[model samples]
Target: MNHNLFGIIVVFAAAAAWGMSGIFVTLIIDSSGCSSVALAFWRDFTTFCVLLLYTLVTAPHRLTIQKKDILWFLAMGCCLGGFHIFYNKSVMMNGAAVTTVQQAAMPAVVTIAAWYLWKEALTREKIVAMVIIFSGTVMASGLNLFTLERINVTGLMVGFIVPFFYAGWTLCGKNIVNRYGAVPCLAIAFGIAATMLLPLQPFVTQPGFLNCKIILIFSGLIGLSTVGAFTFYMIGLKYVQAGIASILVMSEILFAGVYAWFLLNERLSFVQTIGAIFVIIGVAWLSFKKPDAASE
Candidate 1:
């Protein structure tokens, strides 16, 4: 098989696994009455443990980090921690489909931030793509300025805010990822996030919180959604161009929408569906266009 084709397949599979995250989150919340914070904590903690063990076995030297890089990892971890809390909260309030569509704005956010912070080119194509992405996110959120019908204002706000933290996570890890490798950096970041959320650990001790159903959900969430998704994505990046990988990762939005519609009975409105299409088109446009030489 062609290496690029193989990478595309792996990345798509990773997206599919990530798409199931919301379903598992909803199921755990419904069955165990776990708070969003608790769920985030457990997810991070379990993923960290798994990644840590993998690092220990495969590349123990990667675990060592310079003291100077601690701050970078801390920032990355905090961004990831913030992302989890708000993302899960948004999912709880808005359901999976809407939240996932809102998350599609991440690439736009990252693009804008890069231009601002790193002097990356702010090209016409990227500007147009950002506009389309923002417009689509607003529509997908079901926020009608005229009537304000079918809108959860808080959820919409929270959902929209998710991309900022996600972008921050990406930006913060960009430099350090080269130094420490993706898995080790991610393992450390997850550990830091889990540590930050440790105060919520008591919630896990509540009656029925650790029941069989919730346990199973956690296992799937940690094993498939978190660990498996990241592992596949990192490997896929080794074989594919970053732009193509970004485009392929958009599959998560579609997969999440389908899973929500079938399993959770969450349906997107006509406008929302159109908005999702717009987001996909916009992000793909951005992915396909290369920045000018000045930016590179």
Candidate 2:
């Protein structure tokens, strides 16, 4: 298979997996009444354990990490963990609309970061696709990007913070994946993410833990889905630029809508349908164009 095509397939698969997270997370929250931090802790911890076991059995050599990479691992892990913490809080405080709108800015941030850190070019096609994708994400989520409500100080801060860390995580993972490959690097990142969330349980209200069967099952799915999503994303990062990868991942919004319709009986609005179409167009434009086609 062509390398870029493979990366496109892999990243789209990751988006699909991540798209299911909302359903699983909703189930856990409904059944367990757990805080988002607690849910994230369980999800990352389970992911770490499963990946660790797999590494030990299939590729123990991948488990080894260089000394210089330790800090990167920690930073990547914290960025991811912080995204969950802040984004969840933003949703709880400001409503999902606000947070989702905030997240739409991620591609732009990532584009600049990738250019600075990795010298990835900010091509015309990429910039246009990013704008379309972000616009579609807002429309698909039934949000008015320009008419967003005023959030309180806490919500506002965390709302912005969520995408900052998410952008950091994406670019950081791009570098880490190039150096250590996907699975082992993910193992280390998730291990650190799980560790970071573990101690925060006290600060947050966590009732579920292992007490609820539905929460347990959903939490397990979150872990496995996370592993699948991040692994595929990192694999794709090896081929795609961080900026393009971020735009591709925006497909998660559309996928989440699909999953919601399938599992939660939620129906998409007409505008949302149009928004989904726009997202498809944006992603396809990026995926099918020649490698140098978007280059300046």
Best by lDDT: 2
TM-scores for all candidates? Answer: 0.81, 0.90
Expressed as tens digits, the lDDT of each residue in 1-296 for candidate 1 is 76666766788888899989888888887787767788788788889999999899998899888998989899988888888988888988887756766776776666666667756666687667667766766676565657856668898899988878877776666547767777888899999999998987775533254488778888889899988987677666555544345445766766777777898698999997997787678766755565366523
Clashes of each: 0, 0
Clashes of 2: 0
Winning model by TM-score: 2
**Candidate 2 structure quality by residue, lDDT tens digits, 18-130:** 77765566566667677879767777777888778887888788778888877888899998888877766676667654576688788899998888876788888888998
Q: For model 1, what is the error of residue 249's alpha carbon versus the real structure, in angstroms, after optimal superposition?
A: 4.3
How accurate locally is residue 228 in candidate 1, as Cα lDDT from 0 to 100?
Answer: 90
| Candidate 1 colliding pairs, count | 0
lDDT of candidates 1 onward, in order: 0.75, 0.79
Off by over 4 Å in 1: 1-14, 137-146, 203-209, 232-251, 265-272, 290-296
Model 1 alpha-carbon miss at residue 283, Å: 3.9
- TM-score, structure 2 vs. true: 0.90
